[model samples]
Target chain A: MDRTIRVLVGKPGLDGHDRGAKVIARSFRDAGMEVIYSGLHRTPEELARMAVEEDVDVVACSILSGAHNTLLPRVVECLKKEKGTEELDVLVLAGGIIPAEDVEFLKANGVDEVFGPGTNTQDIVEYTKTNLKR
Target chain B: MFSGYPGGMVLYLHNQIIQGLCERKRAGLARAVTLVENGSEHARHILEEAYRLRGHSKVIGITGSPGVGKSTLVDSLIGAIRERGDSVGVIAVDPSSPFTGGAILGDRVRVRSRTTDNEVFFRSLASRGYLGGLSRHTGDIITLFDAFGFDYVLVETVGTGQSEVDIMRYAHSVLVVMAPGLGDDIQAIKAGILEIGDVFCVNKADHPDADRAVAVLEAMLGLNRQWQWKPPVVKTVASQGKGVVELLGKIDEHLEFLKQNGLLEERVSRSYIAALEDNIRRDTVDRILTEARLDGTLDLVLTQLSQGKTYPAAVAKQLIGKYLCAEESDNQ
Candidate 1:
């Protein structure tokens, strides 16, 4: 079955800055990916639930609220708990105002990649296209 | 704590999808819908496997022209349905831009109050070139939604187009929405549109002339004396959530009427026949057309017709005889 890449762009925690998430969502839309933007102030549980329901190839969880350490891992854990082998192998990635020092910690907790500020949407789109497990 | 099977692994996307559907997983339902909407092969498998799991849900079709408050009415209706303690699944179809094929499916956003509720499932489908204002995949998605165990599945059509009325073929109850201050063209088109409504709603009832619009609808219904069930006219200020409960009550009365008259099964059979006939066309005529194009038979026919040497009826007979009858003979 032919499938387009599906991604869930989520903002977990109280970060009201949805500009970056919305921008990435538009980029993904332009790139022909089916993107479900799980708008602002989403908790880890909500993000996980939406990610599974969307069966997204990637969950690009964006956090600008500095709660990445507490929330991102929870999103990853919730995803790991609810999804089955029959669903898309969701890849979790983080973006938006994530401090440089926190990148490795997030990666250690199962975030596939981290996009600090200045990373172009094209780069993420390229990464997504190449990395999607068809 | 790690309950979600890690997302990465070679999952038979088809098996993975239907399994989630069987388990009633929201993610599975959502993904399978997209697969079907895009005409993916997995869609067929999912729908086929999931068919037996359907039929328990009632389908309600909501339709009207753009800005007629269909979405708002649906939002209110979902609340009303939930108040009666049943789960609801909504399918809202929006028009894709003719130029870009992009649509802002913000209907789900308008119904945002129900988004976080576990009892409500919302899906938006872009018409994606379907002239009828309902997606071609609408039927298949309804089947999946039914299988997922929603007690009531609501389908909202792509605004007001004559073809949008085609969607009524799949619903147990169809609400034709109209609002006050519509242009004369809409009134004229009502002759064609009025035939399909199980119930009529004049939404945005706060507007001036709301009663006049309702009177006009009542007058139109009066012109047709043959309706076994006279469609009820419900007035609703959808934005303010007025009269939504009364509309739901009307729906109950209609459903009860259908049940008492044994027409409930008839509506279900009507939808089944529609789905069956669609498949028959897809499997037979569509495939044959494709083959004819590929094998030059269509071009030959076109050339023949252009020269006035032959016509479509004769050519169709020849092709059918060549392919269908020959296949039958070969099997014998």
Candidate 2:
């Protein structure tokens, strides 16, 4: 019964830079959450599918490869498609070098929260802990 | 408003949970698994509802020492199974960090190919301090997957040293994975692992030491004349997806061998008995511990044991005599 909040730390698409994703994954673990690290180069559909299968409260990914505009929203869209928009109760967040101007765009397109560079890992963890409804 | 009627509310929740399970809903299965893993108050009702819906999926256990490519082999096997038009459910168990009580389940990441495939359902589990090498609820969760109607329910454990053989009671057949250059390490575990394997797979077969590993396994098997079905040692390079199809075929052959000899029924019986025993222990011991805590007897017993006035066995006896016997009679 030591189950705390479960989170999926994903690396979506041709992003070989998993350093940020891994760092957040470790941070989440340190924050006492069970993390499932979906390793490098996963498609958006795969991440969404993993989110549903894992029954995780949060699905957070890093997009340092500059594909956040398409990849982040697509992950949300895919989860909606697979689990139904109304039934999918997951918080989709993105981080890792997202530009300041486009942060609002990502959130508007179903990204629950967006964390860019120079953000604190603890802040991200706290955001997930507070925001996740599951 | 319904909180005023407690029994009615529980009944309502029970029906809702059971209905979700019968509809073959993934969310339903996931929820039931969570309930069972946490040993929630609703867990028994869910299992009772699910137990009758089993017997369709073949629970196959894939186990080996760590770093032996078990995940890659499972991924390859998933592809081979799906090629023939069957769905698979995977349960990958990893170790819980002793310090943090959290785990980074990296095994599921390797099987990324099957993630979006509608036919493959993947779940990651932490061992939860169950030294038996799998989650304590692994059997119950397997029941949920089986009830959900997958053709193959594949369970990948945290690998074995010796005590990890509990998987045999849950899985219909076990695939013991090995690789090249493990030296005499396999020899060291011979007594514990030799009896549990139905199929021995030597992964990394492209390596030069592959043949030697296979020979060692086969020679070990040769020394055992008691096996009705002599386990076959198959070679595979799991990363390249080589020999995986053949490996699946070998597993199927073992499945047939088990069925023809009526061992499959025995396996199922053993699985249920194991599940029942675990549930009984949880219900009995957990209730005793909870009642002791509530009644302040737990501290009293600890004080007596620490003072060395009573041995450990006698202390356990006293607690059971006080709380357990009375509770049993009250239930009757």
* TM-scores for all predictions: 0.79, 0.93
Report model 1's TM-score to 2 decimal places.
0.79
In terms of TM-score, which candidate is strongest? 2
lDDT of 2 by residue, B1-332 (tens): 22332477776876666777898767667777877877787777788777888989988999998889999999999999999999999999988777777778888767857677878899998887787778889999998899888999999999667558888889999999988888674573457765689999999999999988988888888887898999999999898999999999999999999899999999999998998887788677988899999989899989988898888888888888887777455542
Question: What DockQ do you compute for every candidate structure?
Answer: 0.22, 0.66
Q: How well is each residue in B160-274 modelled by candidate 1, as lDDT tens digits?
A: 7554577767898888888988854356345556678888999999988898898888887887789899999999999888999999888778888888999999988888887
Candidate 2 residue runs with Cα over 4 Å from true position: A1-3, B1-17, B185-189, B329-332
Where does the lowest 10-residue lDDT sum fall in candidate 1 chain B? B1-10
Q: List runs of model 1 lying over 4 Å from the truth.
A: A9-23, A37-42, A60-72, A84-88, A93-106, A113-123, B1-23, B27-49, B96-104, B184-189, B293-332
Model 2 local distance difference test score: 0.85
Which CAPRI quality tier does the interface of model 2 achieve? medium
